[model samples]
Target chain A: MDLKTLTIVVVVASFILYIAIAIWAKARSTGDFYVAGKGVHPIANGMATAADWMSAASFISLAGIISFAGYDSSVYLMGWTGGYVLLALLLAPYLRKFGKFTVPEFIGDRYYSKTAKVVAVICLIIISFTYVAGQMRGVGIVFSRFLEVEILTGLIIGMGIVFFYAVLGGMKGITYTQVAQYCVLIFAYMVPAIFISVQITGNPIPQLAFGSNLAGQDISLLAKLDEIVTMLGFNAFTAGSKSTTDLLFITAALMVGTAGLPHVIVRFFTVPKVSDARKSAGWALLFIAILYTTAPAVGSLARLNLINTIQPGEVGAVDGNLKYSDKPSWFATWEKTGLLTFDDKNGDGRIQYYNDKNESFKAKADSYGWKGNELKVDRDIMVLANPEIAQLPNWVIALIAAGGIAAALSTAAGLLLVISSSISHDLVKGIIAPEISEKKELFIGRVSAAVAILIAGYLGANPPGFVAQVVALAFGLAASSLFPAILLGIFNKRVNKTGAVAGMIVGIVFTLSYIIYFKFMHLELNNADNWWFGISPEGIGSLGMIFNFVVALVVSKVTEEPPQEIQDLVESIRIPKEV
Target chain B: MSSKENREAYWKANLKLMGLLLSIWFIVSYVLGIVLVDQLNTIQFGGFKLGFWIAQQGSMYVYLILIFVYAKKMNTLDKKYGVED
Candidate 1:
């Protein structure tokens, strides 16, 4: 079957599967809606968490980032996975024992202040909304490409599917559906990767294939890639152009941010026991690692393949250049999407995929009788275009399309769930009308989810930046604000209401302002001229988190400790068997 | 048994294990991946520098193992303190 037909079939099948799970797992009570009835098996929860955690950023853009960013990009791999360790060790188990339905619920009770709960609700909404918008955009892109639909139309359909299941099943439906999604997405991701790995290195495991010697080469795959790229005036595949300090701060920020994300942290609350939360985190990481470990390999191999295709046969010479007519089927396919474009500005028949903008490289290309740069490859196309580059079977390509959609939709549903619950349960019921019946609350939750989906879909239609960049912003906000507040509330019993509230406000304000100033307001200033203390807006959020920690400590010391009843609540949450 | 003594023992053992695991975590990620990476680059594994391997793959594998090990150890501790679920 053709790509369009296959994509439609896969999407329809997934929709039906999601609806089936939602109906089967329809939440009966507030408890079922919030925590999946707190009976999810550890491994099952792990799979769901993996699906939830991977997001559109992981499935679609991580490889793309690594593909271009080269060795410095290892920070993403380390930072993302390492954060799970912090989550598992520092936060997950205790939150599980806290036995709360929502993150705000935990904060409000622990801090003995409704104001703290409200602040957390605001932060959760902001973080989850920022994240969900990216997922919706991801779905739209996949739909536009594979299903031959307008981007907005694709987003609406994705929104509808997310709405149906998420509204009906809540966390219960989302959990089970995420299990199915994890299976589809992981299989979709790895099949193309494995095929490419075997084709390039005669190895099935991408992680090993990355390091193995290329067929008919003396050097390893990375060394070969490095040689070709540098020959073409690109950076080496295994070395980075970013400063070590910048890399360290960026990686640290991402790690802290991952541990702080509300959607990911809330997954721990679904498990039955504190120990299960701990175990579930491990299982989740193992599942994530399956893709994370393979991704760099995929990125490196794709970079090599791209360079080799554009410059076939020889190194840095006119005779080695790939003729426009000789471009592969994959090149033509991506070119149609405008993600891969070529313009022979000098009217040469050959395609020059080099950094012609580099003054030194331009001089060399001129001397070599090369035209202007021919290939304008969009980094976003790397993973989606990989299977085609390797000339893999049509089914693998179809699976990739399906997998990308699944990854996006699964995360969209999870984030939408959080947004809806915060509005319906936390704001409306918990604060507005605590006496509302379960049925009424469920009705409100469904409506809120549908509305949230519509708003998210609209924002996604006109994304401000790349999906991963937007996700990073969301993570930074969460790390600096919500994560710190939640952690302090549980672990530091002396953090009174005033302290928690002050800390969250300060952290969120600092991080958000830094991002807005750098990303939106500082266009006139060179990057080197703007950022304070060499901390780019991306990494400055870590400083915000530190500020939060200090302010909370100092404020709590000056203020009275939480009341006796709140102290008992803290002690109870720390104990394993009590809840 | 007094709840105070039981809670103290449970938390003490848990904190002790956390300290040990956290130290390993720091060593693998910061020590191997960053601080000592240059020194360890001379040591090779397959085709990768040893420090690079730790930065990319080894630390993640260790983190996964750490969680399971911590869980198992904590479970045993929970039982010892009569706090097992």
Candidate 2:
């Protein structure tokens, strides 16, 4: 069968499976809708959490980003995975013991203020929305590419699948569906990586193969990659280009942000017990590590393959580069998507994929009669086009398409659930209509989920140009605001409503302003030289988090202590078993 | 000890374990992975630079182990404190 047909069949079959699970696990009460009735087994919840955590970007863009950024991209891998440690050790168990339906609920009760809950809800909405818009766009892209449909049609189909499961089955449905999604996505991701690893390094294990020598060559893969990239005027593939301070701060920000994300933290609330929450976090990280370990291997292998395909011979030889007219079929396939482009600078009729921005390389390039770099490839295409570039079977390609969709849909469902629950549970039931029936609250939850889906779909369909940049802001906001607030609420009982609220406001505002000043308002001055303490905007959240910790501590010390019950509440959450 | 004092001791023990484990976490990802990366890159580990491997692969593996270790140790702590659920 053709790749397109195979992709549609696989994707549609997965959707059917999700819808079936939703029907089987349909939520009946507010508890089921918000927290899956708190009966999810640790392993199952871990798998579901893994699916919810690995978004479309993780599936499609991360390997590509790693390939291009080289050592610099370690921030993402370490930052993202390291956060789970924080979650497991510091956050998950206590939050589970708190027995809350939403993050804001804990903040509200712990801080003993309705206003604090409102503040948290607003932060959750902002972070989740900023993150979800990108997922929708990812779903639309996968659909358009594989199903040969317009992006709009693809988005509607994606939205419909999410709506069926999320609105009807709620958290219960999302959990089971996400477990299946984890299976599909991990399998799809690994198959091509295994094949490519075996092909290049004569090894089946991608993680080990990454450090091994090429199949017939004496030099190691990393060594060869370093040599090649440096020869092309790029930084050595295994060397750090960014300042160490920046890497440390960025990694810290991502770790803190991951632990703080409402969608991820809520998954812990679904587990049966406090111990289960800790165990489930471990399981989630293990599952996530399967992909994380393999990603660098895939990245290195893909970069090597890309360079070999483009520049088949010596780097500077006149007859080195592949003739543009003789470019491979995979190149043409990607070019049709407008993600890969070629310009015949100096009318060479050959592709030169190199660092044209390197001033020193300019002299040599001019010597070779090369006016400039003649090829431009989007980073996202690296993962999408890897199977094709490796000449893998049609089924493998089809599986990749399905995997991307599964990733996008699972994460999108998780985010939408959090958004809806914050509205219906926290806003409507907790504050607006405190006396509402459980059935009415469930109905309101469904309605809000449906509305949230529509808004997400619209944003996905007409994604703003800044959607990509805004995602980092989501992590920054979560790290600076929610994480510190939650951590202090649990660990430091003296942090009253005033201190916590002031800390959150200060952290969020500081992080937001710094990111905006560099990323948006003053883009021209975003260089390292002008940055504060050599910390880029991407890494500034760690600073904001520190500021939050300091301000909260000082403010709490100066003010009255929390009420006796609130202190008791803190003491209760710390114990694994109830008194 | 009174029940409240027992709970306080249990919480203190839990915090101590977290402190030790979190210290390792800090050293691996930040200290070795970033602060000492360049110095360690001069040394080779198998086919990878020592620091680069730590940054990209080793630290993540360590994080995986730390979580499981924390879980197991906490299980023991819970049992010792008569707080197992």
Candidate 3:
């Protein structure tokens, strides 16, 4: 009937569907719970992987960043998508052949040391916790807006949903629920994008519309966008500002981290065969690419629409700006979240969203009776605000809410499973209680999942909230610690326990110190001037990974090499077939 | 070659293919998109800028291709070495 009603129906329907799948496919054994009995189809596993991989960041925040930051945001699209190549070819098949349940198990056995296993579990916990916090934040944002509930209320509901499925079904239930999530999120994302594209460029395909001319204009959409943004003192929409050094390192870090993430790599273990693992990666990216390609379109088109809406005519003309009183209802809706604010500094009752920091634009602003830029737009609001900006149906707005929630919940459930399994399977069963029964192990896994949800939810809702940028920290941690260790363990047999363990420790310490130094300890130094060789904290992980490689190599040479059996273990994982 | 020799050869070939694929992957996203973005920006492909397009959309498409291509070629390598699984 109305926007709120449709939103409830869609969101409720999806939640019921996910809970039903969780109940129907609830795990009966540890194998069933952890790896879906290792019987998932390559394609189904691929879809599930897509859902798990596309977190709130991918489904919701990415387009918003791309829309506002323009070409600077391409790092996310290319860096994340390209990592699957490494995973499918370098890691997935071998890990599947190794036949392990958890990433740390592979690390422990491959390194032939219990200490290695313990180290990996620690890293897994930290990385997964950092990641799950972002997911919780995503859930909070979606709930606070779409359902018109407090963020805490939304987070509690989200935690409850995840607890039911993740604690009950483990990876098995999470997988099926994720498949449904992918369908809902992808549909919700694309339908509005297609509508907006057509409204602006008369092209049904957003990707095609991105390249096509505007509906009544001869200039291409991107070119027009470039012209408009630069006129307002922002960087050209098609050109980017990240330094070559920073871009190189950031992209490298993100790619390695994506491959190293435990939640994603674990998905490969669900498929049946080594070949299927390989195929599954291909399928996962194919589905992921659909969203990745469309994001840039939604971003740029939405940016153009927002700019035009705010500055309706000539850029510099005072009369061109929309009267603050005449602004659209969505502006007010988002303003209530405190994400979009208007100061009307000159008290002219008009909004100006130009780059006030530009030196040259200061002269123009003074002449135009503008005290300063009067509007503050949060980068996180673009995707959620797109439907309203495009004047799309209210149902589309509701779907975006559901889509954001679905993305966050699926990713949270997946990460919770990783954390739980690492605790129950690796820590408790592998070390503390080797004689525990399967039934007991399964129960422990469920309890661990529930507990993790509570902790993650609390962290997500509390003050000093983990912003979206901390996701980069999670990636950095994974890149610096797990990726180098895992890749070296598989690709280089000479890496002994001493070396692998030393490398990970060194990597984590170095990366975290650099990140913390710039990010927190010296917040004023969080810029290119203070960065080592102009490498941002996000990109420092690549340097940390190099430290790991070098340290491991040096340590291994000075210490006793891996045992003959460990060498053979490496050789086994390297090969795809049985001896 | 002996059976062990054949397996070694298969593994070598796999490594070599992987090296080639990964290098291309590196060149496309890193070199073209970041290192040589300015030079490539001089060139245009219809409505898309060459470097920006490669960075955002093009590299992703190639990444998809690279994985599938590696899988197909590896399957043949596996079968030839009698290690299809």
Best by TM-score: 2
* Model 2: per-residue Cα lDDT over A1-579, one tens digit each: 888888889988988899999999999988999999999999999999999999999999999999999899999999999999999999999999999899999999999999899999999999999999999999999999888899999999999999999999999999999999999999999999999999999999999999999999999999999999888888889886898888889999999999999999999999999999999999999999999999999999999999999889998999899999988899999899999999998787899888989998889878878888889989888889999999999999999999999999999999999999999999999999999988999999999999999999999989888899998889889999999999999999889998998898899999999999999999999999999999998889999999988888898889999999999999999998854
Lowest summed lDDT window (length 10), candidate 1 chain A: A522-531
Each candidate structure's count of clashing pairs:
0, 0, 0
Model 1 ranges with Cα > 4 A deviation? A357-362, A464-469
TM-score of 3: 0.98
The TM-score-based order of candidates, best leading, equals 2, 3, 1
Docking class of 2: high
lDDT of candidate 3 over B1-85, digit per residue (tens) = 6867876798899999999999999899988878888788889887888888888788998999999999999898888888887
What DockQ does every candidate get?
A: 0.61, 0.85, 0.81
Error of 3 at A371 (Å): 1.3
Q: Candidate 3 deviates by what RMSD?
A: 1.1
Q: What does chain B score (TM) in every candidate?
A: 0.94, 0.97, 0.95
When sorted by lDDT, best at the front, the candidate numbers are: 2, 3, 1
Cα lDDT tens digits, model 1, A341-373, are 999876778887787767778788888777677
Q: Rate the local accuracy (lDDT) of all candidates.
A: 0.84, 0.94, 0.90
Better of 1 and 3 by DockQ: 3
Instruction: Report the lDDT tens digits of candidate 3 across residue range A445-478.
Output: 9999989999999889983543555778988889
Reference-based TM-score of each model: 0.97, 0.99, 0.98
